[model samples]
Target: MRVLVAPDKFAGTLTAVEAAEAIAAGWRRHAPDDELDLAPMSDGGPGFVDVLHATLGGELLVTTVEGPHGEEVPATVLHVGDVAYVESAQAIGRHLVTEGGAEFATTVGAGELLLAALGTGATTVIVGLGGSGTNDGGAGLLDALGAVADAGQLDGGPVLFAGLSSVDLAPARAKVAGVRLVAATDVDNPLTGLFGATKTYGPQKGIAEDRLYEVDGWLEQLAEATDRRTSLVKGAGAAGGLGHALLCLGAVREPGIALVAEAVGLASRARAADLVVTGEGAFDFSSRSGKVPYGVAEIAAEALRPCIAMAGQVLVGSREMRALGVENAYSLVDLVGEQRAFEDPVGSLQALGERVARQWSRE
Candidate 1:
């Protein structure tokens, strides 16, 4: 029997590669003769570049760009001939925005990286759009690209500019004239409203909960200035309204997991597998939103394969799991308790992997 092991990053603990290795190792303990295929996955977040790089050999390019805090930082971009993949997290992701200072962070560094990718003469550019550290509605990115005129307003503070009533997007559009820009994200929130970018994600970035309205308003002002109506567009709120900005610039939005799956040929692997195992840090209702686990489960379902999902925390019960195409589910917390699960993720994951293999091995 052949088994496919595909998993996403386990949040603050292991990366997708690490998780896949652990799962494969554990499964082998019970099903020694089972053919195991490891396919680490990502959904346009922190491990996006690493997963694609690991799966598909590409030219990993590096360049210095302005960070979220205005310092020079090295960023990575993957060049696969005429196509380039850029992970925005390299510039302004959660790693760079731990403290509350991210309330005042900018995405100019991400813009600089995009410019560099464009300079590589890539006809198509796929940019990961999650795990950002800004809430300026892409104001800083536009500024770096010469669209927004007030660099001070963009680079200095949290969203405070009500004066961005009329931004000139000609320069940015001209720069992207021949290139295809795709914002790869899993978020479905729009740019403005109760469920929008600032309201839904601002607090996580350290923006005061009460101040979310102000930040959302700031993004709204940017939409108006750019002559865009992205408030109702799904995924326009991703990356602190960066999705809206990209849409305004004639770029398209695609689900991150789908793009990565296509890039990694996950479909063919799933079809060839007798059993599929996928996982993430947290398995909840939100996993339905184009996350790695969901994508992997869907692929398994398509190929008439049974999928088992494992996660650090599994909030959904069996019925919901089945509804999501998961034949079985396991949570680390249940296996070794939450504290230990958080402390020694690797050991706990391996133990859990062995348990699954013992109970459900297709050998």
Candidate 2:
């Protein structure tokens, strides 16, 4: 039987490619005759550069860029002809920030990465904006790009910065006069509101409640200064308002997973596969709302193929997934203890794969 193994990163443990390898290893151990296809996946967040580079045959360009805390960090981007694929999280990601200093962190490195990619003569830059550590609303990014923010008259302006508080963007905007920026995001939230960047994701990024309002106010001010008046802009709140920043800089926002999936020919793969397996770190009610697995499952379902999901944890039962066209669901945590399972992630993945294979073989 033919089986396609496609999974997202295990979050702080295994990358999507590594997870696929582990599952393949286990499946091979249990069913040597089975044909296994591995397609590592992402939702346009971290691991985006690697996956796109591997799939699209791009040159990986590595450079030293500023980190969130004003330190130099090794960051990479993918160059495919005139198009450059950039993952914003790599330069200023949540994983790079420490607890105490994350509050004042910025996306300076992200801007540097963009500049580096643009310096390669790549006309179009595709930035995967998520998993960021900063709440600076891309002020540092604009600064690195030579845009000066005007903090005084933000409330009403034709060229508004999305989140600059005391910062300015006039100088930064002057540097890149003709570059097009495209932001890929999974979220659809405004830069300021109840569902704004700070209120929705600040706590996870280590920002306190008292400071949430402060950040929101800053975002409003920046929006006004940049002359960007579209608060209803979809994905404006993504990647700690990186989306908003991109919007202010004339960037177009698109659903990240769909764009990447299309570029990777995900639908074709699903159509040709006898069975498809896709998953992420967790599967819950949220998984049904345009996540990676949900997107893959939709394609698989349309092709009349059965799609199964194997996650680190399954918060929603099989019944919920059935409505979403998932044939079955499996959780690594359910089969093995969470702590023990992650200790040897490969081993645990292989064991889980073997069990799943055995069950499929019986049918």
The local distance difference test score of each candidate is 0.85, 0.78
User: Model 2, 81-175: lDDT tens per residue?
Assistant: 88998899999889888884545687878889988888878888899987887776676677677765444322121123444454455556555
What lDDT is reached at residue 354 by model 1? 93
- For all predicted structures, in order, the TM-scores are 0.95, 0.91
- Poorly placed runs, candidate 1 (over 4 Å): 150-152
Model 1 residue 348 lDDT? 93
Compared with the true structure, what per-residue lDDT tens digits does model 1 show for residues 1-363? 899999999999999999999998888888899999999999998899999999998899989998888788889889988999998888888778757765678888888888988988899999898988777777777777878554236554445565756778888888889899999999989888899888898888887877777777777777777756765688888998778777777789999999999999999999999899999999988899888899999989898899998899999988889888898889999999999998999989999999999888866
Q: Give RMSD (Å) of candidate 2 vs. truth.
A: 3.7
Best lDDT goes to which candidate? 1
